[model samples]
Target: MSNISAAIPPVRWGILATGKIAALFAADLALVEDAELAAVGSRSIESARRFADTHSSGARAYGSYAELAADPDVDVVYVATPHGRHVEDVMTCFEAGKAVLCEKALTLNADDGSTLIEEARHRGVFFAEAMWMRCNPNIRKIQDMVAAGSCGTVGQVRAELGFVAKPDIARLWDPELGASSLLDVGIYPLTFTNLILGEPTHIVAAGIKSDRGIDVSGGATLTYTSGAVASIAWTQMAWSDNRAAVSGDGGRIEIAPRFHETTGFSHARNWELDEFAEPVLGRGYAHEIIEVNECLRAGRTESALLPLDGTLEIMRQIDEIRLQIG
Candidate 1:
């Protein structure tokens, strides 16, 4: 940490949207001792004011994202806009010389994601995808254990996430918003598998598309060079168990329901079972906030836990899956 970093006790945050996900992140930001929800921006001043009043009384509200990005008091801006608008929103922040933490599925496609990341690097601005699950303490613990051979020679991984999204939710059904179950819910399971098994050598996928041509439900089987296999699924048409598990020759680790945000898991081996648990801070979003704060304070450009390369890789994988299913 620099002297300036040490001088500032709390890192200031600016939220770029006032949607549900943005609200969830703002609420979680309150839980971090070293973070401050300093500002919020929306296309409408009323919406921004409402969000500020509801989430943080002292936070400033901006009528436009450009104004928020231009605020000198804000050390970093969280881009919570829709996936389709990520490139434009993120570029605005970058141009203003502000660090950014954008929501997952960084962009609608790998090419756009690459462009944004390259621009961030060229500008020497800090950037990260808000893949909060990768920042979850419990999930990190699982990664360490698996790397330590706790799940020896892992052979198979199974994961799924889904919810019944109605038509009223335009973002979930509108192709113009870059809506797709794969980009929304499916990214979780795909990321989970990649974290454990590395990149896949082959992928076979099939999906059911809505009238607007967006995938509403899908499943993919990924095969790795080590002969490990992963079966992952996602849907926006119905509810799913939202569970995940990893099996190997030695044992199996099962994450509880809503696995991406799970606080615990069970490891079974030799007719015995052991459990591991960790505290999830404020709906599991605080961890990522903390990570960004630490990185900013330390003058780091990207997170090692959720690296830009990793995010780009996932986007490429999704692109491939979409191509196959289409």
Candidate 2:
């Protein structure tokens, strides 16, 4: 737990779900001084209690999400359920008058996201998609440099993110669970491209379907209005040499591990590799926690780093790709 920023008033947090992603987020939150692990909720009582004890001693463990959300000690909730369950779980928090930071693939589709967003707006509560990579300091630095025209007149950006999937894993293979390589893994590369280029005017995609009828591997080409293009690839059938590069008239920039982890970028003109490392509290996930704290402090419900509009646009593209492949 590195103290990258001074601890502000601690934001009491209720963690919903007792899954791998939930555990990762809870561990990360424990590293942030301004983030309090107030409660953990799971459908199973034993799992909820175990998760709480493992990450935060004396933190409340609720047998149900409702119990966690209604806990007066909790100021906000983090939803870490699977993609298909996002809308129901997130809406449970919002309906209970709790602010939410839900994990990405915000919902199964755009309509569900719009419904959640509208609910949050009507309730006057904060709602955010946990697009953690967008808040990573190194990623932000790249965005800043690009916006500053450091990479001048961006030409083409290419990014790929993939890892071989365990064939028997239900979440990765189940179609009824809204599983797809495009949503689960493709989103990372798609998002990486969109982050730098904004909404694409044209998107072309192709993919091989899984035994369960989900995308197992795929590629996409997104063309921006500025005539810039980004090509991205994702796969669940095999591991990829995941990396990202953006080329411009003036120079090119490289992103190591492109999707997650500590990112380092280099500009081709200088021909020198420079690493921009930011202090990450726990396993580098505290950056998003800090972002949430800053937004809450500023009385803002949405974040500019992972803005609502950007989320919607990206989801629309994902939906389009799924349709095209289907």
Candidate 3:
């Protein structure tokens, strides 16, 4: 716990894009005290200036990622580009001696993730895949309960996350965008399942690919060594129930819409609700920033809430599911 409590340097963050998710994260980061939006860089200077004006406190803005990464004031960079662009974006930051917090699916596959991790280690800089959901305080509480046998031996878990996504888009449906239910939406359930039940020994999956040859919907079942099973489903072509449930011998845990959002959660047993109603501030994304700040202050590279190894293992499972389905 000493390392956990050690003083972390205030991290100067360089944001790498002005996309929707980037805006969301920037807004959330603004709510945290120790994080600084020191700079923003985009392919277009116009976009960079616009984002900086709107989202930050007049931080340095650059027209290119190279310039942003080269900024001496920037201690870390948030790689908020699209899935396919993740590799190039993060690599640029690492090459510039900047630590990085890359978005989910890390890099389209396990191999790319390994490369990035190794590169970060070799450079002696912090590197983390921004699987922010795992850092939510409520999710961590739920994990604690499950691990403490509060739910007894796990029997089965079911979770799903999906939203209606247009078919004609360049991002969600375009095969070149690395678009797929398996990568975009499926990663949520896969991450949640791994957080609760650990890695599965085997996985069986079926995918529904759109006319554009991208997976728009999918379902997967994982069988674990402890005989616990997790079944997950994801879709982008249409909206789903958008709920998550973890069932065990003693009780069940249910997370509501946008389970990753940390709005609230419930626990029940024997047909009676035992616990309910815990709320958090500011969209719930800020906690990950807080965790990152705490780690940086403590001089740690990886977060306890979202460990590097756990991220790689979850990515490997995603790869396996893709291989099994297609």
Best lDDT among the predictions, by candidate number? 1
> How much is the lDDT of residue 215 in candidate 2?
90
Count: clashes, candidate 1: 0
What's the TM-score of every candidate structure? Answer: 0.97, 0.95, 0.94
lDDT of 2 by residue, 1-326 (tens): 33435545588889999889888888888778777888999999999999999998779999998899889889889998889888888888887889899988898889888888888888888888888888877778888888888778998999998898887778888977778888887888888888799889999999999666889999989898999999999998878888888888877778777445544566666565555565555666678888888888788988887688788888899989988888
In candidate 3, the residue pairs with backbone N, CA or C atoms under 3 Å apart (3 or more residues apart, or in different chains) clash, namely: 7-297, 8-296, 8-297, 8-298
The models' CA-based lDDT, in order, is 0.94, 0.84, 0.84
List model 1 lDDT by residue over 38-96, tens digit each.
Answer: 99999999999999999987899999999999999999999998898999999999999
Candidate 2, superposed: residue stretches over 4 Å from native: 1-8, 270-273
Candidate 3 stretches with Cα past 4 Å from truth are 1-9
Please give the TM-score that candidate 3 achieves against the real structure.
0.94
State the lDDT at 261 in candidate 3: 68
Residue 214's lDDT within candidate 2 is: 85
Off by over 4 Å in 1: 1-7
Q: Which is the better candidate, 1 or 3, if ranked by lDDT?
A: 1
Which 10 consecutive positions of candidate 3 have the poorest summed lDDT? 1-10
Tens digits of lDDT, candidate 3, 56-165? 76689899999999999998889888789988999899889887888887878889888888888888888898888887778888999899887789989998888998
